[model samples]
Target: MLKRVFQALSGARPGEQLPVLLSFMALLCLLLSYYLVKPLRDSMFLSYYQASDLAYMAIVVTVSSLVVIKFFNHWVGRIPRYRLMSITYAVMMICKLLFLLILPISGRWGTVVFYLWASVYFTLVLSILWGVINTIFSARQAERSFGFVALGATLGNISGAKLSAWLAGSAFKDWALLLSIGAMSAALGLILLAVQIASRDPETARKQSGTAALHVSRGMQDIVSLFGNGYVRGIALMVFTLALISMAVQFQAYGQIDRNTAATVYGEEFAWFDPPGQHFEVIYGLKKLDAAAQQARLKALGRSGNLPTAQIQELSQSFGRYQKQFESRTRKVLSDVYAYQGLLGVFLLVVVARFLFRFVGLRYTVLILPAFYALAAMVLMFPLEIALIQVLLVIGGALNYSLNNATKELLYTPTSEAVRFQLKPLIEGPVMRLGDVTASLLQIGISTALALWLALTEMSQGRLLLALGLLFIAAWMLAIWATGRRYDQAQQADPPRQELDLHA
Candidate 1:
């Protein structure tokens, strides 16, 4: 039944089945992890630690992830992609065991530690896994199959988004139950990865590495070489743009989100739900309430639209007033209680985003990620007046995860087989996941700066988020553009004529 379902859905090719099957299976694991754990993030840890502290943990983990990638990239090339993947999973299994037993019993700090490891660890594995895929396939096949891969993640994402709310509403309100579910989902992904590797023929595996070679570090060489070589650098730049705009996109989207998110009661503001004028207030905050306004905006867009997130971020130069807009709204929002307003709104916004993926093609979708971010910023920063920053941020997060998954799949295609096994994981798992860790630390460092200055003057922290997000995005755009330019220039050949024509 499952095979039939996949066969029916997978387009472009009927002969190739296994990779599609594995991607879908992996996506299931991803979705399961997302749905089971996301809801409890606040309950488990945010209540205990400052977002800044959490960010620091991420930074630490990213650095460690980098090390893991280095280990894989330098050595894995000596072996087969599938076998190396199995080795990586074995390490993860050990970590999972330790995480399941040690952290659960260890309490708060333990959980936080595990969160960092869990967050950074999986992506580290995936990067190498993809590097392997890039080595094995042609560019065109990668493109066609990407959606299938994304479909798995999308299904997983939507399910996860719904699960958070669904579990809460149903009898499964227990945090322990949610945590258990999360473990199962994550474990499921690991198992699927194992299965994908295990399915490889024994004869094929032995041919590549009758003997296993030790892995070593090229030690920033890959990254440095990435910069030095024009083509590699281009891909890196594109990846960077994806990362940077992803930040700005979160804030911008949040700003627009406020136009729709009606205020609800929680904490000291509990009495305001019954108040007059609340409904009318945010609608106008949207800054584009008329049907004409929305149509005008949509009409201005191509399938992906014109103004990428990198460009829209330029508005921040308007006195830092619009930039401050992000912070003020965030502060206003934090004043709301989590149950009615924060959690509910964030939930709907992210789920809606899942479906939007189908509307855009992968390359164009990624190329313009920066612009979408800018749109989100315009809405949050200027319109709904930044009140719904969290909602927008969540939207951005979903986009970041989904869009990049598509882009990276393409990148992996052109790489050589050995490089894919060795370097790919480093790229996917550590390098990519490391970005999250970096963002967390960045948030903390900026927050600390604000705290120090708050006594002397009002430090605009919300704008601070917007600024960091924009900076990352802008730099990313420039890099990706440069990469694209080089790729377009990859040695095009003069036509090859028949030998008979030359003889004639």
Candidate 2:
């Protein structure tokens, strides 16, 4: 039954089944670990700081990512691949546990550390994970099976996000519990990975184990030399652009969440209530009483320009209720939005995505999906209806994630094992981090300028968002085209590795 399901969904042969399943499990655990804490990390940060602070955090992520990559390259040089992967996963889990233990003692600094730690952990771990997969699977197998493997990642994301949301909404909302869950998931992924590799015969396993004793370069110059290759450079830019588009869509989606939440609570007229300090009280007071009674109460308060002691006490008592109501309503709204996103991902993976990679072709499929969505996003910004905006953003986000993920792995299949291991860390780690930094800084500058312009000119920022989104998408499309061309050139010049049935 499991084989049938795998075959039906992913077009996997019996020979391809085990490694595919193992890769699926490994990616599932990796994403599950990350998503479990992602919401808490973002929400906690936003509670204490402005969204713009993410720009600073992005800078930290970029710098830290480079150092980690350098150290990672060193490990890739010294340790066997199997031992290195195991140690990396174990150390990451230890970090999570350590953070879990110290969070209570650390206070605000803990939030900072968690944010930075999560960022670096995600980059380093995912790069290594994909590198491992690239090592195990041949190009032919990866092309056929990566989308299917990514289906597991999609499900993992949904499961993890839902679990986090459930725990946060439940009465037993504890950060420690969430961290423990993430740690366990990480450890499970590592075990699965080891099993997958070991399941191969000893001879085959040892041969493919490390970098073939290749003298892989190690240093700041490694990244520079890696990019000197046209194919590697193209993949890096493709990743950068894809990350940029994803970032822009994310920024817009978050804005819609804030807007929709306010609209849900205060109605369309809420914007008018911004400047008047008393409007909130007046609105709440009116909702609680008849207009005549409300007018009478206001008149009484207006005479003294202050509330009576009893009235002040009554207002104070209701404050907690108002705050709780706001929080609950917003949580529900955001939950529904995220649930929609997850469903879109599942549908894409289980239904349309595998078809695209299998039939529609990787290069054009990758280009078309995000390009169309980017155009749709640009068009939809005109109305800015919360529902339409949210839905489109969710769909676009899901497609970009799954498609880019599956195709990018295929790009590494043509490279040598040493190049795959070393170059992947630089691309996935520092290059991707650099993309994030680019997006964050761009978001910050655009937001700051828009805020000031809107304050002075009383203009809408919607058009500005649309313009910038379109600009990023244009660059993204160009990157995709160039990368696809390079991929074709490389494939034509050098044929794929001989197909291997490793599990046999």
Q: What Cα-based lDDT does every candidate model obtain?
A: 0.47, 0.64
**Positional deviation of 486 in candidate 1, in angstroms?**
5.0
Q: Which residues of candidate 2, in runs, are more than 4 Å off?
A: 1-5, 104-106, 175-217, 259-336, 380-383, 447-462, 465-469, 486-504
Question: For model 2, how does the per-residue alpha-carbon lDDT over 1-504 read when each residue is reduced to its tens digit?
Answer: 877887876666666676677778777777767767666666655433444466678878889988888888877767777678778877777788787778657756787888888778787777777777776666566666777788777766777677666766777556633554564456456545645654574422543653345455655667776667665676787777666656656666665564345334544334332334444545444434433565566455444546666654454334434434444454445545555666677777667766765566656765866576567766655656767767776776677557667777777765666666777888887888887788777666666785676662212454455466677667666766666655545445445333221112
Residue range with the least summed lDDT across 10 consecutive positions in model 2: 495-504
Task: Indicate which candidate wins on lDDT.
Answer: 2
**RMSD to the hidden true structure, all candidates:** 15.4, 7.0
Candidate 1 scores a C-alpha RMSD against the true structure in Å of 15.4
Q: Please, what is the TM-score per model?
A: 0.62, 0.79
What is the TM-score of candidate 2?
A: 0.79
